[model samples]
Target: MTIRTTHVGSLPRTQDVVDFIFARERGEAYDPDAFDAAMTGATAETVRRQVEAGIDIVSDGETSKISYATYVKDRYTGFAGDSPRNSPADLKMFPSFLERLKNDGGTPTYARPMCVGEVRSKGQGELEKDIANLKAGMEAQGVERGFMNAASPGVISLFLQNDFYPNREAYLAALADAMRDEYRTIVAAGLELQLDCPDLALSRHMLFTDLSDEEFVKVAGMHIEALNHALEGIDPARVRVHICWGNYEGPHVCDIDMDKVFSTLMGAHCRYVLFETSNPRHAHEWTVFRDRKAEIPDDKVLVPGVVDTTTNFVEHPELVAERIARFAGIVGAERVVAGSDCGFGTFAGFGAVDPEIAYAKLGALAEGARIASGRV
Candidate 1:
């Protein structure tokens, strides 16, 4: 039984790609043709790199996106105004550490656009370009198994505050309808659609800070409901959902426990769930899967992260094998896939891990999956 390897969407972007993305964010004029050519070259390089690193399942690396959630502002209507940035509660508690993080140039300046009008597809042509770039890259690499990421409705709602909708449900409904276009577009492109739904776990410490874990589950259920609506008619097997409690180097003391939201997350229409499993705070939570084994549908698969992305230290191949074996012990080796805790380069200019080091870590993931193939 061989363990398959994939990463959460997003690998490091080249300086030229980063410059073009930031230029669009700044509303500055640029040659659209030149940007497209640069992005295509960059994407092909990333795809070829992933294949060389021994990845089985691959992504476009989200080369065209500014950030996972905020990129929607460009494709959809209603996200035009500013939204105040709120630091995670745990981070705010340690003011000195927060200061140090900022001083270290950890914060990449980007806009958090708010929903001031109705949410609808604006016909921006970004999704189409994204699909073409990814397909071209995969074609060049002779890679057939691939996926592209789209922000889930819940996650979009979390970052882009809704000022137009009368209530949270209303806002979510609008987002679901609007984002449905992107969802279907990706699936229609003959590639798996990965829905980035960090709102499920990350919001507990960031967006819904006032609510207790129990209460937060109720709200996240609403988020999943909206996502399900957006996923209508799409095959569950063609989709994967990524959940994490914020992808940053910090004291994540207040992240909601997986036990509290595991059931709510399984309620999604997606068949595969990719989650953080090897982080310092969450490594012990593998027992959460063992404890709730009955709840996982047979058709569903688990992609547990065997590599931690925030730190620079590359995991030894043996340790990665041991971690994968732990999950296989609970759910069978056939049901598990190797993954990373989160995307190394989440935002265009904001990757904490060095680009070369990130690739080296992924290289370790491939080697480790090989090590776990039989022993599990």
Candidate 2:
């Protein structure tokens, strides 16, 4: 069986594309046709790069989004002013490191708007352009499989804080209701839908730092319920949930062990579960799946991150092969797809890995999957 290769959505955005996205986000005087042309061309180039890297399953590189979560501000109504950036608990322990990280040259500052009014879909036409661009890009490149990333309702609540909603449940429900349009639109357009849900584990360190592991699991389950409602009637086979513990290079001491949240996460109605496994903090957690193999339904696929996205180190194909083989040994080779730890570009200007190196890593992932297929 050939193991497929994919990634957790966002890839680096081109400078012009970045300029256009940020301008629109700021409500500045920008040309709508210019934005459309930029996105279309960028999506085409993004698909070509992924195809060149030999990725069997490719994404549009999320060219139209500002960030995985906060991009919702452009699609939905109710967001008004800037929201406070959450301090990840572990990062807070080291003031110097936190400050340095924030000042990193690769990081770009963008607004995180808060919900100030009732959440409603503005019926933004941006999603349509993104869908058309990706579909046309993939078809032109002769790629068979493609997926589009949508911000999870739960993650939106985490980033774009819920100030207007009376409680967390009401906030999530409203967010879910607004996001259902994007989710359905992508799926209806005949592409796989990847729900970016870093809120699953990242929240433990960011938003739910005050809660115990058990308490956080309960909260995560409620979030999953909202996500499920948004994904209603969509075939689980066409859906995947991408979860990570904050895609940053900080010392991840505050991350909840994957074991603590595995069951609750499995509750998501998605066909594929992609999470971090290549990063140092969570690399060894593949053993968690090995230990609880039976908990994963036979229909479920595990796409483990075989390449680390937070660093520039190019993982050797042999190393990537070994990592993929380990997961395939636990599950069947057909049930595993190699992927990156998180997005290479989680935001428009966020560049943890150099753009060239990110594609190289994807090339390694493809080669690794081929090697693992031989062994598994």
Q: Each candidate's lDDT (Cα)?
A: 0.90, 0.90
lDDT of 1 by residue, 283-318 (tens): 999999998999988877899988898999999999
List the lowest-lDDT window of 10 residues for candidate 2: 101-110
Candidate 1 is scored at a TM of: 0.98
What's the TM-score of each model vs. the native? 0.98, 0.98
lDDT of 1: 0.90
Q: After superposition, how far is residue 304 of candidate 2 from its true place, in Å?
A: 0.3
Expressed as tens digits, the lDDT of each residue in 242-343 for candidate 2 is 888988888999999999989987889999999999999999999999999889888889999999998999999999999998998898888898998899
What lDDT is reached at residue 209 by model 2? 85
**Candidate 1 regions with alpha-carbon error over 4 angstroms:** none
